[model samples]
Target: MLLLLLFLSLPPLSAAQLCHPNDLAALLAFKNSFSNPNSSLPSWDPQFHCCNWYGVECNDTTNRVLGLDIASVDLHGTIPPSLSKLHHLQRLRLHKLPNLVGPIPPELGQLPLLGYLVISWTNISGPIPSFLTNLRSLSYLILSFNRLSGPIPPSLPSLPYLYAIDLSRNLLTGPIPESFGHFLLSTALDLSHNMLSGDIPASLGNVNFSRIKLSRNKLSGDASVLFGKDKVADTIDISRNSFEFDFSKVGFMESLDVLDISHNKIYGSIPKQITEAVYLQFLNVSYNRMCGEIPTGWKLKYRSESWDNSSFFHNRCLCGVPLDPCK
Candidate 1:
């Protein structure tokens, strides 16, 4: 009788929670923010469990919204600031939504756990908000192929964990902030196809990038800082700019596979050290002011696959087998 009484005194176990009601309400508001989301979100039935809804993921134990991935859908809406309600949201991706317009909502700063945030290939406009620095956990921030304008925030260096940043194909102007050089080591930096003008910051030489592209901008000055025998950059493209640097003195890293300094005001002969870069695959030195016989080496010695006359054309005077013999 004592054993049975002890068992009867035990408290009843409660079932684990469902998606937080507030989180569910936030998602519903996000759906309503769109003018035409019914067809795209057919599975977002109010009666069903939000964890089972399309493009929404919830934690297995707490049943709280954890991730939201909605790509290539025909939803026409600004990112609803209400999304901040998902206190545990970690990944938020909204890609290839061509009709989606407006600026990134500032309320995203409240999501302290947000790490991966992508809003690419859409029509989001306006300056990238400074509030994004509040995302202390941000790892990858890609906002390419949009119409964002204005100078890049100088405070971006404050994000302690931000690694890869892609703000390419936007309308951004002004010199790249010197703080950009403080980005974590080997960060992939792409600020291409923008109207950014002024000197390429000298500070950039301090960082070792995995790949760096500043092409099709109005940038100028000594790009030589990016090159050194000790540097480990894998690829560098500063093409279609007014950059004037002495290519003859610049050294290449063995890791270099692609280098495009074409259509610039750069002078000096192609350095002989380029021969040491066996990983070279794509090269375009055309339309520059460089002169002298082209350097000969593993990849440069061959006149096929972009080592030919066309690659060395339109220069003041370049000789050797690719052109006519130096006389």
Candidate 2:
């Protein structure tokens, strides 16, 4: 009996806690599909329990695969469809694997418990599958910096729990969807650096996103609606687009930290009320069709960051402390 107690106390059986064999096979199959040029996947050998493998996590009670994060590991190859066999997976992040190219397998949408799915900065291309709208448990979805093309999937907003989405720096085209306003839980939505066009959806004004970035696209239309009475987003960057809206209608925002709307067709006098935004730290309205004297309060009182003469340059007409005094 003393020998039995000593054996039990030595160190609770480590590898003897067997994981579900099917889950082990699924993970082994996932590792087998990738060509590991940097030897980043050495620990994924099938000889060991999959739960002990690098970048794989399993439930303590059920021993089912629950998470897989193979980010920035120089992994190459398409995401294996076998990963869908991880029926209990809740989080999967495959970020910054630049050499990993190919379409995301639609089979991945089958992971019923997936709550966080991020596949950023890779070479993945193709339209985002519309079936991802059924991921009821998803709250954070990031597919940024890929080669993905096609309109933002119209069915994407159907994920009721989704709160943040980043599809930035892709090859996507087409207008922002009208249903975007329905993402009531979203606080951050970035669709920047794509070839998107068409009018900004007026409905976007209804959503209370705290950060919205629609910059470096070909979007056109009056943007006054985005800056209208709802006034929630604190960081709004719509610069480098073809949007047209007078500065007068760009209402005051008390919470604004950064505002960039440069290189557009916006024309009109800079609104003096813009100075009322004490929280404003960064403002870029240059390279537009704007004209008239710069607001004195903005020129003298604002100094959150260093400004170059170019910040006010290239306007249709302007004069003030920053621009040789409107003569």
Candidate 3:
């Protein structure tokens, strides 16, 4: 009789009690203040609970809210600080919400169980909150094409599980932090189209990468030394900057498919060694002080625009390919 009484007294699991009270309260608070221009967010009535909310998902056994996806929802307002209350949240996608503004909440870093985060193409501005470095379980973080400014925090590399990080197309200024080299496990690191200025960190050459784009910045120094022979994938774009150095000593990019180092202050001859890049498909080194016979090779013969320039007029020493032989 005692066992039966104990069993009968236990509250039954139901959708109404899907999440922790605090978690539910936090979600409701966020919904109340933010303007959802499209009315895409589902009715977050407490009686119905979060289980039926548009983008939210609950763990079947625990009934705790585990995901929040608001991608392209036209959400406007600051990221609610109360979002941290949902300790079990595993995925958060707020991509392309141009209306969203204000600093990314530091409280987001307090989520111990979070995994995926995508806020790209939003109006979110300010330094990436330092608290984010604590997300040790993060696998994918995409904040590219935002208005975020300031130095990328050095602590980012400490996250052992991070695989993809895209911070391109921001106003971020400062040297590519030396800490970037610590992300040896990263698959794609895109820091392009920023105001970052400094020598390409040589340490980056040590990390194996699949696609690395550092183009259209104020970055300088010899490109050859900055990208070591890592035999990874096939893309490296460091074009449209003030890099000035000799390209002759630079070794071949055997695995490279696209290389765009155009419109820079680079001064030197296109080294014969470059012909060894067997897999090169796209090459653009135009508008620089490159002089000498364009190495007759499979890639160069087809890419006519790869050698365009007024620099050829200044570089009286250059010859062959698009230009007539040295006079």
Candidate 4:
């Protein structure tokens, strides 16, 4: 009788109660928000348990919603604010829906555990929401290949755990925030192919970034601060900008591998210090105002076969090993 009494006190384990009622309603509401979800999410039917819905993951012990990953779906409509109902949502991705539009909902700031938030390859527009700073657990922020415009939120770096950020290939305009120099934990940053202008915060010179790409923008001023013998940055691509710096003064970190600073107003002989970058596999200094003989690193000749004729061309004054002999 004691065992039967214990069994009778346990919650029902019916298929309909597989997930928290709040999570189930939130999922159904999210499906309803989309105008054409049936073709992509047929498994999200009300007759079945919400945990069995495609792209939804639930915790085994609590049966609470944990992840909602929906990509390449024919979803058409704004992201429903009702998604905030998933109090335990940790990963939220809505990628490759070219038709999904509108600004990121403010309600998302309510998700305290959200770590990976990606809504790329869509028509999502408007400024990046500053409220995103509230996600104390966020680590990855990928909003690339969209129509997002306006200034990047400076508060992004304040997120203590943010590890990577990619806001490339957008229509953003304005100068990168000076507060960006305060980041101490972020390792990778890509703000390329936007309309950002003005000086790169010299404060960034102190932060040790592993990879930083600021190519194809209107950014000007000396970018030499990003280079230093003490820094360990492995990749630095700031090509095709109006940057005017004396390349000779720049220092190459031993960890340098990819360096592209072409198509700028940079004037000076190619720095011999670059030869010290033993791990460098990609180098492009072409289409600048640089002059004098290119440094044939005793190490460069080993990789000379990979250096194309155009790699050192258009500088008009660069000469030697790969080109006609210096005059």
User: lDDT (0-100) at residue 101 of candidate 2?
Assistant: 88
Residue runs of model 1 more than 4 Å from their true location after superposition: 1-17, 299-304
lDDT string, candidate 3, 1-327, tens digits: 999999999998665566678778878877876876236465666767677777788888877888888776757788888888888988988877788899999889988888888888889999977788788888788888899999988888788888788889999999988878778484678889999998877777667777788898999876665454545647878888888877666665577777777777777787776676767767777777877787766544244444454324445366875667656
- For residue 47, give model 4's deviation from the true position in Å: 3.2
Candidate 3 weakest lDDT stretch, 10 residues: 302-311
Candidate 3 clashing pairs? 18-63
Candidate 3's TM-score reads 0.83
- lDDT by residue for model 1 (118-159), tens: 899999899999999999999889999988999999988778
Candidate 2 steric clashes: 2
| TM-scores of the candidates in the order shown | 0.91, 0.89, 0.83, 0.93
Top TM-score hit = 4
Residue 319, candidate 4: C-alpha displacement in angstroms: 1.2
Which regions of candidate 3 deviate over 4 angstroms? 1-14, 19-22, 36-40, 43-49, 58-63, 299-319, 322-327
**Number of residue pairs clashing in candidate 1, backbone atoms closer than 3 angstroms, sequence gap of 3 or more or interchain:** 0
Q: Model 4: per-residue lDDT, tens digit, 187-209? A: 68899999999988888886788
Give model 2's TM-score versus the native structure.
Answer: 0.89
Residue 63: error of model 4 in Å?
2.1
